[model samples]
Target: MVTNLRADAARNRERVLEVARAEVAEGNVSLQLNEIARKAGVGVGTVYRHFPTPRALLEAVVGKELATMVQLTEQASQMQDIRAAMEFLLRRTLDLQLCTSGGLAEVICAIEDADERTTHAKSEMRRLADHLLERARAAGVIRPEITGEDVRNLMAGLERAVELDPDRADVYVSVLIRGLSG
Candidate 1:
């Protein structure tokens, strides 16, 4: 591990991660290692060296993308405008779920499970929801009874809307907001 890989080798590793980001969650995260190696202009052995197991590679790829959502959620939580944060989180979550419908259940499940602990991913989601809810409730825009937990569930199923009709994502999102709003 101390030995540094050549410049090309380092770049190839990054390329593999990038390509796998989208492909991994699709269940096709299992894209042929050889093909990735080819795309990365490296030998299959190099890919093996970086990721010895299929599961390890999938975890790495999906983990990185999940971290991006966590970050967005954390930032949204800190925004001064509650409505903006709420809207941003909903839209970004929807975008990710819809675009990755091929394997969304896993991602949603991953987030949901993580929210049970104080992990960075879970904490980000909670923080964002709390900030948004506080603003909405104060504005009397969201139902007083609405809890951050409800938003959690709503976010998880936002992807389900994708399966009904891809073109009606906006409508589904609207419905979600209405149902969640006071």
Candidate 2:
């Protein structure tokens, strides 16, 4: 996305993104534009020009993570062991969510307001996840009632739980995987 901007504008945008990424990684999702502007040494107008709202900035920050999730799902869908694929996808997705401190989850949860690029990434993620779920069901590895949306929301919930109790992340993942299995 930054490829189109002028040199200085690209630098400013990168600075803003760096600051915003740090804030989100630290669980400070407020992402106030003025604060980001001050921290990035850019003017408020620069911040606005680059990202009009906190969600826009957040989408920019977590865009790569969303893409990674889609890639992971695609890879998972290809594996022969459907159950192992599901566990791998869930674990890796949860790891990404935890690394971002739930920023990806926040963006995904607000799909209605997402930009076109983010929406497309989310849709692809959903489609791939549903494909994985269907394969798991056919293999009799996952519960018949569980849908892709349930998996996504459950992963988000696991991320929140891990945020609150970091030490119990492994236990939480194990329980979630077990609960989802047939």
Candidate 3:
């Protein structure tokens, strides 16, 4: 009976997370716990018991994507061609950001007091991104003045542009890459 109850609780938590993810993916950043509970078909107490706060829920939703970003940065750092690696990182990062409805950017770029895991992931990504930038600059593939923060802000701007005009994302990225290469 205890095992069954634990299994049921786990299922409820997963359901709440699923609904919350869907809400964020639909561009709903102001995740209301009560609404998530309603959509999850679970009680408010259950949702609170699982997530405690909206920030907690948002962190959970974006955590995987954050890890993926870090992984992409690490992968880019290992590539033989610095220019190609930088382009690959930019494209993959933008793709991931677009797919997550910009949630990853909101969390990593805007949120300052994220939970420990998220904070650590953000730091790791920044470190790897900085290393990639250094390599690109050393190889004379990109402008020497561009910093990681600049790249982050540029990507955020591109995300907004793509959101406004989805068809031109590739063109926008291509233009960005060309401009960065100088």
Candidate 4:
């Protein structure tokens, strides 16, 4: 969507995106465009000119991280070693849950009315789930009963738990992975 921009405008847009993403990642659910503009050394009009609404800005923040996760998951799923896939997934899940980006994932997941844009997220998760669950089960690593839905629920739970104690997420992840095995 972002094709071309003046140098100053491009810098301003990048600045807003970075600061807005960081703020939202830090649990600032109500972060506004004006605040982002102020932080970016630009005027509110400039921010609004680029991003129409707060939701749009938040969506951009979420989408940026979502793209990264999609690439990571897709890449990991293709790995020949099942343990590598599982470990990659675990690391990604832990990062998303414990890092500032965790907040954005939680917000996106919590939305009651997920539009067309969000629906694609589910499909991508299913891809990761199928890859990991099948490999884990075939290797007799984890139980066979765990489905893709189960994985999704686990992710949501992990996100919630990590939000409560970001510092303890590593411990929680270790315990959770252990429980996943047979």
Candidate 5:
């Protein structure tokens, strides 16, 4: 009896987390606990039992976002054109960051010390960015002086721009692309 109860509780918690992630992704971070429970097909008490606070739920959603970014980076690595891949990643990343409340900066700040998945994702993102930058430089598509850090900083700037004024994100992204292209 105890084992079955524990298993059910675990399943319910996972369901709640999954639903919460979707909600956050859709810019619904302020969704009430009861609403989440209803969406997850669980009781309000179940959500409270799993995530005691709104911050905890947001933290979990941010973790999911991080994992998604890592996956996107890995996918970008498979693209044939380095510059195209970089552009795609930048656009996709900006879209995701803008979907959330405070953008990537806030999500990153929420995480204290990332878990293994987040850490691995960060490393993989860095490696792919470096590889893409090297290829772009070699192909003369991007300025030779540009480094991976520069690309990251540019994305950070984009995040801030999106956070401040989402309507102008496209303009900022265009400038970033133009500046990178040789």
Candidate 6:
């Protein structure tokens, strides 16, 4: 009976965390405990019992996003064609950033409070990015002199362009991808 109670409690916390992550990633950072509880289908008190405070919940959500990004970068590194993988990473990342609400701000904000796990995740992402650039260069799909920092800056610029002129995001991304190919 005690085990079942513990499991149920854990499940509630997981559900709350999931909803909090989506909400924050969607740029709704002013998350209310009541709303989170309502979304997670748990009691308001249950959320309080799990997170104690909104910051705790937000921190957990940020950690979850960082972990997710690390997994994605790892997956990208394993793709057969580094160029295609890079394109996929850019498109998918931008899509997530532009989905309903901007995720770039969320990512930037979370990075400021990055814990050890988040820091490691970011480092792993950078390592994977470097590997991808090397592979793409070796394959003659990208300029040999191009570095991971260049690609990272390009992505940041692209995100900014999209934020400034959302309707032309597709055009901007296409041009950037073509430029990278050269």
Candidate 6 deviation (Cα RMSD): 5.2
Better by TM-score, candidate 6 or 2: 2
Candidate with maximal lDDT: 2
Pairs that collide in candidate 4 are none
TM-score of each: 0.62, 0.94, 0.90, 0.71, 0.64, 0.61
C-alpha-based local distance difference test score of model 1:
0.66
Q: Cα miss at 4, model 4 (Å)?
A: 1.5
Q: What tens digits encode model 5's per-residue C-alpha lDDT throughout 87-138?
A: 8888988876766654354544433432445456667777877777777788
* Per-model tally of clashing residue pairs: 2, 0, 0, 0, 0, 0
Overall local distance difference test of candidate 4? 0.72
lDDT of each: 0.66, 0.89, 0.88, 0.72, 0.73, 0.72
- Candidate rank order under TM-score: 2, 3, 4, 5, 1, 6
Clashing pairs in 2: none
Could you list the CA RMSD of all candidates, in the order they appear? 5.0, 1.3, 3.0, 3.6, 5.4, 5.2
TM for candidate 4 is 0.71
For candidate 1, list the clashing residue pairs, or say none.
Answer: 24-29, 143-182
TM-score: model 5 vs. ground truth: 0.64
The per-residue C-alpha lDDT of model 3 at residue 144 equals: 92
Query: Regarding TM-score, does 3 or 4 come out ahead?
Result: 3
Following a full C-alpha superposition, what root-mean-square deviation does model 2 have from the true structure? 1.3
lDDT of 4 by residue, 1-182 (tens): 47789998888888898898789767785668788888988899988988887766766667656666667778777888877787778778567645554554554355442334645764676577687688889998778898766765687778778778878877877777777884
